[model samples]
Target: MDSRVFRGGRGFAYLEEQDRFLGGTQAPEMSFGFIGCGMMGQEHMRNAQLVGRASLGGVYDPAPKSVDCALEIAARAKGTTKPRVYASLEEACADPSTDALIVATPNFTHLDVMRVATRYNKAIFLEKPIATTVSDALEVCRLAANHTQPVRVGLQYRYKAVYAEAMEEVFGRQSVGRVCSVNMLEHRFPFLDKVGQWNKFNAYTGGTLIEKCCHYFDLMNLFAGGAPEQVFASGSQAVNFRNFAYDNQQADGLDQAQVVVNYDNGVIGGFSLSMFVPGAREELVVCGDAGRLHTVEQAQLGSENQNHLEVWAGESGRSRSSAPTYPSYIAKAGHHGATFYEHLAFVEDLVSGKATGPSLADAFWSVVVGAAAQTSIDKRTAIDIADVLPVTDDIQDLMLCGAGL
Candidate 1:
């Protein structure tokens, strides 16, 4: 139970030791200013309280009812204090008391949110799918890379125990030696409505892949070697909120998608998604020179078939034991308990002066590839990742990013 006090400014007051196990309910020392008090924002609110380590610095939401909703959730979660309700993100960023900020706004609003946050030197935890366009994403990266405060992109799956273990065994130890193809498949019900039903419009979500598939894209970059070189994709908005005719919501995003990527290293990575399918489940299979690793989760997996992982050591007819995943306390149905780990990891990074994150660039490129895929699907052609996204001048070297794991 070894620990150290983090002398960093306000929000990063407490830090978790690197060796600490996930789901340890130590109260966070830092105070947080949360932007966008929506469903995802409130979920993080619950996690911050559950950690018992974080306190509220302030909270921002444009809608009057939304602010009330978020405050109600915080109270229900038994958060230490009801934070100040800020009228705008700019207001939250300028406050000296606010140590760190968590940006959980919609896809379209991210650039504006980050632009405000960068004005201050506070540590930041920004949500995934940096922006709707490759250029906007690059600008956000440039701002963060140049800012003095530490920043982490919210690709929480990287913090999950299953992924950590898999990464170590396969890439770190070379158990699955050189990975050739990393494939992912997700079949589930159609996208549900968010507050204001903003997600139904491309103007708000930057298309379905950027809105939802960013996590999978981040993972694909992680396991499939590095930045993708080119992509070929196909999908249609044939179902869900639009074409299904069950609902009146007008939408123009893909309900089913398949993206094939060729990495610079010649490793091919692919992701298949179907929102209209029955029985929610996701399967990720990675094959290498040695053998392969496969993982499956029954959407919620519930109490019965909880998420599981399997590893095959080599091609010599050997297999590693497959079983239910570990770190269950933090492995809630929402994100396989990844929420808890992400909070802890961010806190640890803040306190310890160490940050191995879904780096800003790492986050940017996931959208970059996805945006390109959308282009490929629409135009019926193969698109190169490097061509669509250009290198920035001096503020940020785009090459140094996009490769971060």
Candidate 2:
């Protein structure tokens, strides 16, 4: 193992070395185009500046404000010039200067955006919850599978300091031994306002589960280590946006949900979400025969983010605890610094032409699990994965094995 590896920030050496190494790498600079230019798109713009090799190529959005905000971010970057504002999405996708595309469009428009993006055959970094419906997600997967350029999903939670280290402990070191169960919890404030209030309605956002909880489901699926067998969920449009109307439509998105998933390998996973909580906190716990691993990131009243990881072994072994964190600059880039690493991985794949990180199938299964959970909530019954995903064996194998990006 390299001596410079991140070891839960135990000492100053690891972080110092990490800063030097990540900051010093001479990666090939790559230009990127943006499709949506919404809140998330601007976030990608911010993180792209942190990536030594990534530069803003252009942006396209129906909303002029979004375009202006994205351009402002590009202008603020130290060494980068202002990005072009395209009048149409097609123009942005087909622009020769852009080497890659990042789709940060609304959830419902993903399939449509992808339909156009795939035609251009540029490496794409698509935001999560691939589409509003399972069939649409499957279609997106098919398009990505056929695209020549590498296509990757933005499941960046895999890079969070706590979760990344927890993944290393559970899968890399097998510290927790044979995993038997995985459980997760997220408590946070209600959804923030978006342009036109699209997120407040299931019709536009694919329900709360498909839109908000897919990231956690993706993480759960990865840790479960097998295809999901079934899902049982209970949720409601409890507090936020209730009795609230936009454009004569009431917000029907769920504000609370409890979901359980059973994997084919007999590993079970549970997730709890509360959108009305006072603060923000996320927890992941994995249990195995030998021991258990727990990691958490929490903050209150906009305080400093507290990221922690702990591993416990029974009487026969030792235990350890530590706080894992990224450098302050990186941490503030976006998504608690996860997006920085996500962009790093995307750029690496774009340059090397090797597909790693989250693939299209990962996006599919993540949406599948979320859709199943939404269905379970609607029907008040458990949803079988087989029933939800009734495709041919080849497609099933592709979805289950996660062969391509």
CA lDDT of each candidate? Answer: 0.77, 0.87
User: lDDT score, residue 288, model 1?
Assistant: 88
Query: How many clashes does each candidate structure show, in the order listed?
Result: 8, 0
Candidate 2 Cα deviation (angstroms), residue 2 = 15
- Winning candidate number (lDDT): 2
Candidate 1 ranges with C-alpha deviation above 4 Å:
1-28, 77-79, 243-249, 300-305, 314-318, 324-329, 391-396, 401-405
Q: Write the per-residue lDDT of candidate 2 for residues 1-405, one digit (tens) a residue.
A: 322133323354444545764333444388999999888999898888777677788999999999888988887654577788888978998999999999998898999999989999688889988998888888888888788888889889999999999989999988889889999999999999898889999999888998988899999998889889999999998899899899999889999999999999999999999999888999999999889999999998568889999999877378999999998878888889999999988988887876668878888889999999999999999999877775766566565556544
Best by TM-score: 2
lDDT of 1 by residue, 1-405 (tens): 422222213454254555434323456588888998887787687677655567877889887777888788667643257788987778899888877898898888888888889989899888888888888888888788778888888888776656766777677777677799999888887887677777777777888888888888888988986768999999998777664332565667788999998998988998999998766777778898888888777754233444667878755556775554644444552466677778877878888878866788778878888888888988999998867776646324567443432
